[model samples]
Target: MELLSFGDTGWGDELFKATFMTILVALVAFFFGFLISIFIVPLKLSNKKLLNYLGNTYTTIFRGVPELLVIYLLFFGGSSAVMFVAKIFGYKEFIEINAFLTGSISIGLISGAYTTEVLRGAIESINKGQFEGAKSLGLKKTTYYVFVIAPQVLRLSIPNLSNVWQLTLKDTALISVTGLVEIMRQSYIASGVTRNPLLFYSFAAFLYLILTTISLKYFNQLEKKYNHQP
Candidate 1:
């Protein structure tokens, strides 16, 4: 209707832009979260007690805390924390972090903890004898992991990673608190402007459903292909 019609007269354009922001934030968070998992999983599985403890403590803290609180902390406290560190390195100034970057980093940290657990479990589930066999072939450490273990771990991880992706996608809604004009934030603004919460909110929900459904379908196809491969 008029409320959702395109251009300045309606919220349609803003909603579309917000949707794009949602996808971008989710992508940023998921990728960085996976990167974090790569390092954290190794630490979790490391022989050193201190490294293992560090990983455990990280996972325990991030997993134990609410994602919203993490974003709030990062949004409000992150700049100060950054400035504090900068001061230690002979710099004295307020370093501002924009909402998008802050939201992405905060959600990425939360997603990373869950990803670490999933990846660690996947890595541990692999047969230990494979590592010895790879070593016997004289493969370098990176080559051994890439050639021998990464594929198996990835296959084992797809389902859990899919779930994490869902979680991360949904969690992007919470980043509205940081003033990023993603779906939920746009919905709030439109609802407030038009005084028609139901329509805008319902549309917001539908947008989320579309994103999740498409992502789930993609993951399903990926999982199936991985399973069917020789």
Candidate 2:
């Protein structure tokens, strides 16, 4: 109890801040992954073999690799990659990629692969008659997608996206290896300092449980709302 106090006497403040960082990183990574999925989805759906092959390869590689390895590779190699580009442009200074960006990108790449699959499934589940109906109505391509296809895709995707959100949230714990002071990192620090590993780790787990529960409830509400729509 004293160990969880809010002042300098305890690690509560640090843990609270770490929890916030966890949420921030999860949100950013999820959205960034979704952005990546947007481009890849079309490629996977395309009739061209080359484009489909490229998209499938991207998803397969990221999904098959270990998440921690992805983080390690990106964190260690990102700066070198940037510096290589810089030298090509005649700016030869050393570049360093911060832990936050590295962690976010690594997690985002993984998330994107899963999201692409979820979205692809959602799109495929839509009845073919909807497309034919839209075309028969003489709707422009852009208008048809915007007003018809996108909403249903979103509605269909919400449940799976919720799963993605949970996965992304849990994945933030892995970013501790990059030295980001997320929940796991903070817990590790506090445990080492206090020699009370069980307490700190349990607290960290509690915080994560709270986050996941709240997010699950919110997604359920969203699912219900969408399901009720005409």
Candidate 3:
């Protein structure tokens, strides 16, 4: 209780706030990654040689690179990239990409590459017969994908997607270097100021455990909801 005091001297409130930022970053990365992965997976599955090569190249570069290197690259280079685009649009000044944006985009890019592979496998596992049947019923391609393929792919990919979510959550800790002020960063600040690394680090670990447990329960519920349908 003493260690968790809310007074100015204690760091409990700051740590809690930092944890929220960590969750926010993780959620942003996961959602954006999932969204981008849709196109990547389809491209990879296409017969077009160029699209297939493009998808393969994206996955190879992201996955082959070290995560820390990716983070550093984005942290420094993201703002420059944004500024270049801004200039092309006739903007005079630089378009600054904040640390949060840098962190989220970097993680999202990396996670999306992995997610593309997972989603491609799930989409492939679905029988080709179903698509043929949908066509025979006079269903439009878009409608068939939305009503039939999308649901099945999401269901099949949940387990692997859950793993990616966990990885993203852990990876958010690395964004502290970009000055995101997340859980790990806050813990470091507290420990350095208070000289109680063990205590602060233990608190950070417990918070992460709580996050993982809640995420597991939520994913389990989602799995059950999608499992049986009349």
Let me know the TM-score candidate 2 reaches against the reference structure: 0.97
Give per-residue CA lDDT, model 1, range 1-230, as digits (tens).
Answer: 88988898999999999999999999999999999989898899999999999999999999999999999999999999989999999999779989999999999999999999998899889999989999999999899998899989999899999999999999999999989999999999999989999999999999999999999999999999898544
Shift of residue 72 alpha carbon in model 3, Å: 0.8
Give the Å error, residue 215, model 1.
0.2
Candidate 1: pairs in clash: none
TM-score of 3: 0.94
Instruction: Enumerate clash totals for all models, in the order shown.
Output: 0, 0, 0
Ranking by lDDT: 1, 2, 3
Candidate 1 runs further than 4 Å off? 88-93
Local lDDT at 117 for model 1: 97
lDDT winner, 1 or 3: 1
Query: Quick one: how many clashes does candidate 2 have?
Result: 0
lDDT of 3 by residue, 144-168 (tens): 9989899899998888888889889
TM-score of each: 0.95, 0.97, 0.94
